[model samples]
Target chain A: MTEQGTTSTALRESITAGLRQAVKRRFGAAADIDAVEFTSLGGSNRTVLFDLVDGTARRRLVFRQETIIPANSPFLDPARQFRVLSLLYPEGLPLPEPIFEFDDEDSLARAYVVAFVEGETVPRRLLDAPRYERARQRFCAQAGEFLGRLHALDPAPAAFLAEVPDSIDPLATTMARIDRWGGVHPALELAARWLERHRPTSTRRCLLHGDFRTGNMLLDEEGMRAVLDWECAHLGAPAEDLGWLCLRSFRFGHVDRPVGGFGPREPFYAAYASASGHPVDPEEVRWWEIFGFIRWAHYNVMQAYGHQTGARRSAAFAACGRNIALIEYELLMTLAGHYH
Target chain B: MTQDAPSIDELLVTVREFVQEITPQLDGRDRYHAQCAVYLLDIVRRELGADGTDATAEQAMLARYLGDGAAGAAGLAALAAEIRSGRLDARSDELLADLTRQVVGKVRITRPDQLHPMHRESRPAE
Candidate 1:
């Protein structure tokens, strides 16, 4: 959070003024915009919260804008994000309701406003807090079942996704992105080569929540409420989502709890199999898990590079460069058959 | 070339103290940033304390694996491209051992805490 009287305050005020008018025009009502506040410094988008007072009721809405400098991920696109939410929201998925999206025509920066759904998104808190005890008990099986249902959806209707070239051959696309990051390591290189040789050819393709991990999920006392961060969603093998969720990093120190630090991997797999009618293959999931580590390590290095190259300046990113070594350490441990 | 009063070690200690001094005063997001600042300084301290042979050993492994004298990021990039293109065998035990050595060497400096509990017993003496 920036201090008051800084340049950020001035910019925030200007954005609030513009947003007040935009909200009135979109809602077709003279609603009063009480205040606009920055919520999170997102990786690919800037998130803000504002309240709209309509007569006697007040509604809290969130606005997400495509960051000026986006993270280097193949699956990120503003239009695709909107399209997925628009499609999934109707299918009864627990996610924020889309209010409106702006494109080139809108004078304000390209962004979308949605209903603010609150819950816990942090990992350690979800893992350790007694408040989330109920959520922890049901999270793994529910998350697996939810992902299975998502993969069961017919991706054909979202044909606009075909415009994104990397929708197919995610391995080659990931390899290209890693090479462009300019930081290389033998462990990552080995993982990529090994994955290339062992990549599975799925008989069935479906939409994958490319980042369905604990940190991305919002949980309450009841259980998982909404799966957030759709920027990385894409069409791929169903097991890829499972593999990513079980990655050691997402486990947040509970390496024993392979399924998002919630429970063992078998129960999660069993739930998914029962729900989707597709038997889970453990070997394929392991291969994708190795792929996940390599992808994550490369991403950390890329984030640091983003700061180093003047594309973005962040204290957190500078720290991320150092964090890559930790991921590389885990990558080697997994590759050497010593992780388990 | 003139005499400097504060050595690198003293500078690191000063920064650590400064972070401690300001930590209690900050709350919420500012506190998190301060913690991150301290973490960066800790990494710098570890880097300074390392014996500094890790890079040389890593380069040697890269040279051996690539079967050429290639050494830095350019060399590693070329090697990665080779492995991806099937010019080099990625399944060889010797290659795996060298890559493991490289990863272990890095983690020793950047984050020894991540080293496997079993592997920690075999860490080379400084």
Candidate 2:
């Protein structure tokens, strides 16, 4: 076998053995694992799905391990992500049930397991499939309701989220990341000036699913099943999540339907207002939507830099280097009121 | 010296076609990477096919803002610095127009499909 193949084999074996120990510790010695499969859905983590059989009961669970975290990554650490799940899962939110977190004894570093939620998370499939037409109709309200419920949750427990740079000052945080990534983006600099000058008034800071958007959500034909990918969760303006959900990038070619390419924004805004008792401000969301483009561009730059600097090597990331121009064009258009 | 018959653009098109044909046979990460390869190849093809007019126009536009001494990447960096330092805030309207043109030039190569209708209509006839 090649050197990389050999390394992967060793890693797989280690994960299997570690999982067996973890399962036995949680579900007794009779518990056994079967059908371990790695999933490529996660961008910065290793996701492995396995079925645990204890007597007649078989439960499919996901084991996610943090693989490559850049030094300036905005994602929450594995431990903090698990903590967020633990705190919010009991709130009756549509989230994966946290099974157990790995400790030193489990021999799995920075990994956690949660019960697998069944649904489709692919944006294109959800947006284009005829079977999802009804689901798309209901998606906006459901997303708004979820965000309202999520933002209503007490921020005291997730107080640790405040330490996130974005939670402090998102514009400064974005600018810092841009500077760190070599910062020659004149368009982004223009965006920074606009965002700085037109800062939104202080609103109630709440727990935000920082990466809330189309692909981050799992939905069936009925509606949303679970909100996934809480790595970007942080305490911030409630509208940040709403704006992120409406980002053109997340619309997946269905840009006409601003709400995750599902439907109009009014249903979402109305649902959010009804659920949270806070009136939806279109202007505030617009401000955030504009900021969203810049943030999205920053993320693309991050990926491209990672590829060029050999921190990670992937053709997809290499494409992001050029994709930045597309994003900048969109940003300029949005700023000029020529495009949403 | 003259180049071969199968030039860079031709080679890119051929490779992109091959990758697109083989994409269905691959699955998961390989399939995703193949799709990205197709996109990158298309970008290279468009870039290679472009004339030098846009580049020259962009440099002249930047020079208008940053003076003749500033040009190319250095000019862009200087413009960004000026924006960040708030020196260009008064000239934001003109800067925005120049930046829009600069970014549109790039999008013309990377992804013309993403351009606004107005911008698309504004593109010079082939």
Candidate 3:
């Protein structure tokens, strides 16, 4: 029983009316309350896909809630993450324009739900179906530009400033945070030890996707529409964000190259640096790549829990648990790759 | 070691089978028991398989990264093993795990053949 995505702790429908009421009150007549239906999907949070009309228009909105999973963020307050999304949406990040957020005692059993955005987020299918290669430059350039914009965001924003931790060594902090996840298994313990010794110095703190990578974003031929999954979003070293995108794991199988199935490391860095006006460091890139493994490993543990306890048991979590090894192996290679 | 040397997959199958068989028999709510079974199976399975590859890899990584630090830091000097041996009994699992982590870019890129993405995040938009 490999743990799959974040598993539901209180999956039972304890209070459906309360959630609908919360939505109706916050979004109000703007969302056309009479014509909406909610259906829950996914295991990480209670994901409800709601079909509703707004001003003689129909829209399908998605909402998410955090459930019980091993290795969940003890440090992160879900309300805090929701608040961050609320703040950043107005600033023009390509993220789903978050609408109607509430994290209290009776919101879908735990911290849950915001307005859903639409887009297909597939990387495996990307290699075969309607390839982005046709629109690679636009996709690449747009992603680079978008990331640059995010990087350039005034850390001065009260929304961002209030919640995000100001850590001196964010790289170590990231590893330490993830290392906490490794305790679930002895092998992950190995992963923890591996990350600690290899942690890198911080370049400049910027916003992190927390889970930024290939599978976490939405893109079309034109380019990235928006980044998704801010569960791990925080202000951190700028190199961390770029490095996360470049992490080979994000490439899925495209290890020969990096950057979410893009061309190569140099191009991805060049595109980002050009757009953001920040110098790229191979060393820092290397560091975040390790952090990516730590993050992935924790997520993997969460996935295992989702499969074992929660309902979404499938080949997905079982196979994903094995992925932890890939990251561990990659770490091995990264260490041995340039050992003196 | 035949009984003990079950492949990771085999162990997982056994755990799943065991949980599936016993969960229905539990006196309490079937779903609750079933959920408990799933998590328990996962824990057992992780303990079974995580060691062979992860532990050995950690050992090899630490040996490689130590890079002549302590004159006698070389691993299994008797075996003359280079970095990459991931055996818990073989070395410092704690330190080696961290060292390999640093070297491999942390994404833990392994042979694609070894990994299979169980659930890919298919972004909702093209």
TM-score per candidate, chains pooled = 0.92, 0.96, 0.64
Error of 2 at A178 (Å): 1.3
User: Per-residue lDDT of A171-211 in model 3, one digit per residue for the tens?
Assistant: 44544554443322333344445555666665466665556
Q: Taking the tens digit of each residue's C-alpha lDDT, what string does model 2 give over A81-198?
A: 9999999999999999999999988888899999999999999999999999999989999999999999888899989888899999888898899888864789989988988889
Pairwise lDDT winner, candidates 1 and 2? 2
In the range A1-340, model 1's lDDT, one tens digit per residue, is 3332132866787778767878777765768787677765566567778897888889988888775644555656666788889999998888888878876556567678888888888889999999989999998889878988898889897666655544677677776776677677666777777787777866778887788998888898889888888877777788889999998888888999999888898879988998788999988888888988977876787788787887865667788887887887777677778774
Among the numbered candidates, top TM-score falls to 2
Error of 1 at A150 (Å): 0.5
Report lDDT (CA) for all predictions: 0.78, 0.88, 0.55
Candidate 2 TM-score over all chains jointly: 0.96
Please give the lDDT score at residue A73 for candidate 2.
89
Model 1 residue runs over 4 Å out of place are A1-7, A71-75, A103-105, B1-5, B27-29, B66-75, B121-126
Model number with the top lDDT: 2
- Over the stretch B4-86, how does candidate 3's per-residue lDDT look in tens digits? 66777686778788777786675423445465556546645555543344445445544454543322223433222222234
Q: How far is candidate 2 from the true structure (C-alpha RMSD, Å)?
A: 2.1
Q: Which parts of model 3 have CA positions greater than 4 angstroms off? A: A1-16, A27-42, A54-57, A69-75, A103-115, A135-137, A158-203, A301-322, A338-340, B1-112, B115-126
Which rank order by TM-score, best down to worst? 2, 1, 3
Task: Say which docking band candidate 2 falls in.
Answer: medium
Candidate 2: C-alpha lDDT: 0.88
Please identify model 2 stretches exceeding 4 Å from their true place: A1-7, B121-126
